[model samples]
Target: MSRATPPSLPFPPHIHAWPDRSTLLADRELALTELHRHSLGVHRVLLLWLLALAAIIGWSLLVLPVQQFEERDPTGFLLGPVFALLGLASLSPSVIAVVLAVRRDHQIRQLLDAWLALDSAPVSDVRLRSPGLSLFWLLSSLAVAATGLWTSFGTAAGAQAGRSTYADVALDMGIGTILWLTGLIGVVKAVRHYRWALRTLGPVSTAGRR
Candidate 1:
């Protein structure tokens, strides 16, 4: 009689019960890539606004020598420092965004290690745990607008100084308008993206069962 086929071996305890570590790592990697992509777009937009601001500042410097600084609006003079401060404030959101990107990247990489399989975190928890970059942008943009208003005050002051003519005032005001518009657009886009990311990720309530 033919011998009975050998019985099938049982799977190892840990291997059979636990989820695959490699699969979890792969998922985390994909998520990290998407986060980086979105963050890069936001950074690029900010860079454009920054470049435009630099251009305006350069133009202002060039004209200062040729045209008399007219101080027309008394309030405009006071706005000079205010606008400068607001511009400084805008840095906060950008810095936070960078930090958030770094944190996510590091965490994802660590999760890949075989020892600690990446656990599924609730979307709400992830969003809450991560830094809020959008809020920073919103606050900073408000500061930018406030600062621009202050710059207008400075322009008026220049008119009052009677150093520059009507044309100079118009030019300064026009430049201010452009900067404000660009900043506003950037702020709006940033907010929209942040909201979209939050929604797309959705909320995770319970921990991964496996």
Candidate 2:
């Protein structure tokens, strides 16, 4: 009599197996590399946009007729410069934070090397979190955009009263639109990066817990 054949396994044996240490280390390195590249790219883009905005503001201040702006809405004209200055100043912290992130990543690389060479257990205590650079950019951009919107509204009101021209309102609106779009893009990028980091690194450990 022929014996019945044994049933086949549902999947390959390897499918349910955990990754080896080398594989895990390789994955962690790749993730860190990708994160570094993405963060650097974001930093460069933000810096470029900020510099462009600053240059545009400076050019406008030099070329535009200050007297005409003042006549349109004295309060808005004064507030515009103040808001721009504040926005410019806010970027400083983000720049410093980006630099720090780069340095931290470098340190992490060294730590990874040591762990691999020593064949030690991976450090589960270390965790990565979202950097606040994006939020700062968002807030600063919003402040500048708000200034532009206020200026635009003031100019439009003045025009209705025959005290300002449509051109003034149009200019303010354009600046406001640019600022808002730039800020929105930064915010989206920041949130995306944050989510990506979380996904790549896995869930963070709770405070006071191993």
Candidate 3:
């Protein structure tokens, strides 16, 4: 009798292959390394951005003589609101980074445990994308845009009242516009990076393995 060929596996055979423990471990390491690399880059950029924003807010407060002006002055009246906007923008990113960091740590621990387990089953799919971060970015972008709109309205009102100079209004509007644009760009980039990561680490099927 002729020997028979083995049955054909499912589509995307490479991904669905039931690899040996060593191969599984190697794949896990590769995935973890890529994740860590991207995570570090994202965290570094966000932290630096937050620090720079804080510095700008501090410098603006120190240099502007808003305190000397009476509360009746439009510039003085707008000072608190403008500072609050900047502070909130800074806080959103900080909170996102912190939450991500904690989740990342937990993920690392789970990955390690999965790799060390004696069972031959494929690892469960991990959630690389964070909904919390996505939500924060979405809300932050809206907040930034809203703040810009408010600044524009205030600038127009001040101009009409002859209390604020054109240069001052232009500067505030420019800053607000920049913040809104940058925040939007960051959200897009971060989301794309996460999606790329998920695709790169192809999900393994646990149908056949124990």
Q: Looking at candidate 3, what is the lDDT of residue 139? A: 57
* Candidate 3 Cα misplacement greater than 4 A, ranges: 1-37, 40-125, 156-158, 190-210
lDDT of 1 by residue, 93-147 (tens): 5445544544643443333222223344343224432335656556666666566
**CA lDDT of each prediction against the hidden true structure:** 0.48, 0.48, 0.48
Could you give me the TM-score of model 3 versus the true structure? 0.42
Tens-place lDDT digits, model 3, residues 36-122: 434434454465357436544643443244432533456655675676566566555544654575465446434434432423333
Compose the digit string of candidate 2's lDDT tens values, residues 25-74: 55444444444444434554566476547644643443244434556766
Give the Cα RMSD of candidate 3: 13.8
> At residue 53, what lDDT does model 3 achieve?
64
Q: Which stretches of candidate 2 lie over 4 Å from their true place?
A: 1-31, 34-37, 40-42, 51-128, 206-210
